[model samples]
Target: MKALALVAALLLGTAAAGRPPEIALTFDDLPSHGPLPPGETRLSVIDGLVAALKAAHVQHVWGFVNGRGLAREAGTAGVLEKWRAASFPLGNHGWNHSDLDKVGAPSFLDEIDFNTPILTGQMAGQDWHWFRFPYLHEGSDPAQRRAVRDGLATRGYRIAGVTMSFGDFMWNDAYARCAASGNDAAIRQLEQTYLTAATEAARASRHAAQGAMGRDIPYILLMHVGAFDARMLPRLLAQYRREGFRFVTLEQAARDPFYAADVDPRLGAAPTLEARLKDAGGKPLEIPSYSEMLGAICR
Candidate 1:
C-alpha cells in the first residue's frame, strides 16, 4: 500500500510539472475600488488585501493608482504607501481614470503627465513608470492611439496590457450591491460566479494565445481593490494555483515573447494579444463583452 502511494505521488508531481500556466497578478484603482461601505475603513480593506496576498505567497504583484480616486477619500492616500510598504509595485492609472476613447488624445496625455508627481511621491524613487489605460480603451481612432502611445513612450512609461480578466470589476460592484441589501443568497452566488468566471477566463486566455500565437505566453490578470475582492482573493489565488498557474510579477510577465510585439503606432487598438494576432492575420479568440457578463448577474 505504501509503495502504491509513493508511485501515485510521483505521478502527481510529474503531471503537475507537465503544464503550469504562468500569470502576473495586477490590481487597478488602488487605495479604493469605488466607495467604501459606511463602517468599513479603506485601511482595513487594504490590510485584508495585503494579508491575502501574503498568505497566497505572491512575492511581487502590481497595483495601478488612479490619483483622482486617492484624492476622493480623505486619509486614504496612505493606501498606495501601504501597497509599496508591502512590497508591491505601483503604476499610473491616469489622474482620473479617464477613458482615452472618449477623452481627446491631448487630454489623455495631460492626464498621464498629471499623475506623475503623485505616483513619484508614492513610489519614493522606486521605478514606477508603467501606465494602464483606465478602461482598457486605447483610443477611438488610430491617430489618437498613436499619439497617446508616442506620448507614453517619450515619458518613459511602458503600457501594461491585460490578457486575463473576468470582469471582476462588475462582479465586485454587484457583490457590493447585494451585500448592501443583505441578500445573502445572491452574495453566495456571486462568490461562486466570480471564481467560475476566473477559471473559465484562464482557459480562454490559454486558447487565445494558442490559437493566435501557437503557444501560451505568460498572461497578466487584471483585478481591483475592493471589499469583496479582498475577501475573494485568498480563494482566487488558490483557484489559480489549482488551475496550474504560477504567479509572476508584471515585469516578469512582460518578458514573454508575446509581449515583445513591435508597436505599429497605428490607430484602433485591441487587447495586446488580440491586436498582435489580428496584425498577423490570425484568428483571435472571442470572449463575451463586459456588458454581456454583467447582464448574467443583473438579470
Candidate 2:
C-alpha cells in the first residue's frame, strides 16, 4: 500500500512539474479607481491590496499610475506612497488617463511627459520606465501608433503588454453599487461572477496563447486597484495558484521572446493575443461579459 501511494504521489509531482504557466500581475489606475463604496476610503483599499499581495508573497507587482489622481483627489497620493512602502514598483499610466486613439500622438506624448515628474518622485531614481496605455488603446492609425511608439522609445519607456484580463474594471462599479445598497445577496452574486470571469478569462488566455504562439508565453495579467478588487484579491491569487500559475516579476516575464517588443519599446508594438491569434488564423476566444449580469443586479 505504501509503495502504491508513493507511486501516485510521484506521478502527480511529475505532472505538476510539466511547464506550469507563468504570470506577472499588474495593477492600473493607481491611487484611485472606480466609485468607492460606503465607509471604504482609497487608503483602505490600498491597504487591503498591499496586505493581500504581501500575504501571498507576490513581490514587484507593478502599479501603473495616473499622476492626475494626486491633484484630483486629496490624500490619494498616500495610496501611491503606501504602494511604494510595500516595495512594489510604480510605472506610468498617463497624466489624465487619456486615450492615445482619441488624443493626437503629440498630445499623448505630452501626457506621458507630464506623468514623468510624479513617477520620478515616487520611484526615487529607481527604474520606472514602464508604461501601460490607458484603455489599452495605443492609437487609431498607423502613423499615430508609430509616432507614440517612437516618443516612448525616446523617453526610454518600455510598454507593458497585457495578455490576460477579464474586464475586471467593470465589476468594480457594480460591486460598489451593490455594497452601497447593503445587498448582501447581490454582493455575493457579484463575487461569484467576478471569480468566474477571472477563471474563464485565464482559461481563454491560455488557449489563445497556445493556439497563437504554439505554447504558453509568460502572461501579464492586468488588474485595477479598485475597492472590490482589493476585497477579492486574496481569493483571486489563490485561484491562480490552484490553476498552477507561478507568479513572476514583470521584468522577468518580459524577458521571454514573446515580450521582446514590450521589453524594448524601440521595437514594433507588442502583439496582443487577439492580434497574434488573428494573424495565425485561429478563432479568437470569447471573453465572458458581465455587463447584463452587473446591470440588473445592483440596479
TM-score of each: 0.85, 0.93
Native-to-model Cα distance after best TM-score fit, residue 128 in candidate 1, in Å:
0.5
Q: After superposition, how far is residue 125 of candidate 1 from its true place, in Å?
A: 1.4
RMSD of each: 5.6, 5.1
* lDDT for each residue of candidate 2 in 126-191, tens digit (9 for 90 to 100): 999999999988877989998988888888999999999989898899988899899999988888
lDDT of 1 by residue, 213-272 (tens): 777788999999988888789988986776667888888888775665322222224456
Score each candidate by Cα lDDT. Answer: 0.76, 0.87
Candidate 2 colliding pairs? none
Candidate 1 least-lDDT 10 residues: 261-270
Off by over 4 Å in 1: 1-19, 261-271, 275-299
Give the top-scoring candidate (TM-score).
2
| Model number with the top lDDT | 2
